[model samples]
Target: MTDQLTYLLQKLDASAHRYAELDKYYEGRQPLAFLSPEARTALGSRFGRMASNIPRLAVTALAERLRITGFSDPALWADWVRCDLDQTSGTAHREALLLGDAYVIVWADRLGRPAVSVESAKQVTVMTDPGTRQITAAVKRWEDRIAKTSTAVLYEPDRITRLVANQIGAVGSGFKVVDEIANPLGTVPVVRLHNSDRILDRHWHSEFDGRGHSEIDDLIPLVDALNKSLADLMTTSEYVGRPRRWATGIELTEEPVLDEDGNETGETVEVNPLPESHRMMISESPDSKFGQLQAADLQGYEASVRVILGQIMAVSTLPAHYVGVFTDNPASADALRAAEASLTARAEARQATFGRSWEQVAKLMIAVRDGRDPQLIDDVRVQWADAATRSVAQEADAVVKLHQAGLLPVSTALAKLGYSADEIAEIRVARRAEALDTAGLDLGRPA
Candidate 1:
């Protein structure tokens, strides 16, 4: 038991290092310390933080579109809402997208109802079986700064042990057992929601288990480039993006100096009458005509920034417009669909992978609530909101054609038309009532 707790704590610390770095970028904290003070001055405050939020944008653009509507099991779906999975899942999903994986811990509340909560990767880490990818042991560690104490919870397949240390840094020295809880589910109650949880295709992910690929990891470099270019542009605008007027034959007029008491002094002083950054310049000689030094050509810097954005698009499933590149005229419906094809595909992939994890979570919730076999809810399925961007006419036309062709069922057609579950149920009831009324009437003879 001691050896297992020690190993899990080590793993927790290792994972925290990576999570810290990712969290910094996701929160718009620039990783690079500028070499020059001017660059910092230009991009250090509000504008800089805003420009560095590209990584944040990349993660959220897809996350916001992915919503879990319902579960296939009606009773489970009802329980899902009662458990407040809607709000908790929103927070968990976005964090998963940002940090690669987020865990949901299931337990029973005081009311004997299933309680679900999201744990961030920063504070939680788990060791998974290599073949099954099921968590063998998990630990969540947190420090109470005010009390100068740290607490760690180790979650195993059969038991949950809570341990504590004197200080956050002393977690390695050892911890005394503070509490323990029984988990009879025979599996860990924590379920992981992953973003791009694929094996190592590139150098981005670890070859080991218990980790998933982050959504913004690869985009961080591009985000840095974008921020760098933006800082440069802003610096240029502050230094030279504005027009400067130069005079070839201006005279420095001399005036008698005045003493502090307003008495004239013998010394004469020369002062250039032109104010700094003034819009106009005046001189007595004809050669004094002002020649303006045009503002710096920003196309190069902006083009470089756009090139970085283009590279991001090339590597990821994001489209050009998602990164803020826009055209003079709005894209045609077909063009917009074509552009967002990859994005939609990515969202679907998330729905598929995340759906499986959610199923596990639902099973855990039920098992915690009713002490029943999870396999009883084997028919569980995740219902995702439509991620496609289509016009109203287009959706209606496709739904009508598919339903008439017998390719899509009426219930499915209503779903395609963006009807909610409750709305569709109401529609079906109304239809049934209308059918009964028609059957009772003598329409054939009256018409």
Candidate 2:
């Protein structure tokens, strides 16, 4: 047991470091940290400070655009899960989009109302059984910087426990468990949300077990190049525009002159080809012309920037138009679809992983709210929104065709077209009422 705990602690420490590195990249800091000291010095502070943050932007864009298309929004779950989600601010969706690894901890608030909140990756570490890949435990450690203390919550299958320590070692260091307590929540109250699963030679690892790769991993180099290029351009522009003043073959002499009192008075006089002046004073010699610094070719820098952006678009699988660059003509609908195919596929893949986590969250929420066994709510599933862009008319037409051809039911078709269960039910009720009113009028019978 001690050896197992030590190994888990070591893994947690490594994960913390990995998470911190990812966070730094996402926040656009330390872009040139990997460079050697000599190389970094050569780049200077301006280049070091210039961060395009394209990687961050690309990842955020994908996460934001990958909307949750569907979930347990039917009438069966209206009171149990949907209402609770509304009260909790739809945390599952928000957390899934922002954090690659999201955790939901369920508990009852002071008023005994079931509550759920997203936990930061820094504070939560998940432990899973290697064979079954089932979460065996989840440990949450938080430190009070001001109080010089730390607290850890350990959630297991049969119980929820707390550990308090006066001082906790850095990530991998084993902490002294000074105190422990079991909580009222009998079962593990946390669920791990992974953006994607990692595979290894027919074996699978949870996102928590390994370092999760970000969507913008391939675009980091392009972003760095773009920023460096921009910094160089700015420096060149400053040098070219700097104030220039020069003087040559000029001399100053002090001459004695008689003042009004007939006493000797001295005054400095310019004894050169040109008068002393703040402006560029040209000398009489033909070889002494005013020198001017030529500006660098800004067009070249602009072209390089465009090329870097193109590379980002290609590697990230994002559309050129979406990245703020466009051709003379608007892209056709088919072209647009083709361009977004890769991005849509990536979003769908994320949905597959994140969807399951959401299902677990829904189950936990139901358990907390109704005091039912979470394991019993196994049928909960997530519905993701359409990953592709389509016009409203196109979507509605497709759904109507499917419904008329008997390929899909009206309710299902409406749901696929992004209609909520409540809206679909209301539409059906209104249609029935109109039919009844028309029959009562007897307009078809008489006319």
lDDT of each: 0.77, 0.64
Question: Each model's TM-score, in the order given?
Answer: 0.83, 0.73
- Candidate 1 local Cα displacement, residue 83, angstroms: 1.7
lDDT of model number 1: 0.77
Which 10-residue window in model 2 sums to the lowest lDDT? 199-208
Best by TM-score: 1
Q: Write the per-residue lDDT of candidate 2 for residues 224-328, one digit (tens) a residue.
A: 787777776676565553544455544444556668998777754445444435454645566564554554567888888889888888888777776777662
Lowest summed-lDDT stretch of 10 residues in model 1?
A: 200-209
**Which residue pairs in model 2 clash with each other?**
68-385, 69-384, 69-385, 70-383, 70-384, 71-383
Candidate 1, 1-447: lDDT as tens digits: 777777767766667777888888888775553337766765566454545576777678788778877767656666677777876887888888887788898888898788888898877777777687668888788889999888888889889988899876445457889899887777877888877655532333544354667888788777777777777877788779987767677888888999999999999999877868566676778867667798888889888887887888876777877777886223698888888888888888888888888989988887877887665756577788888778999999989999999999988898778775666788999999999888888566566
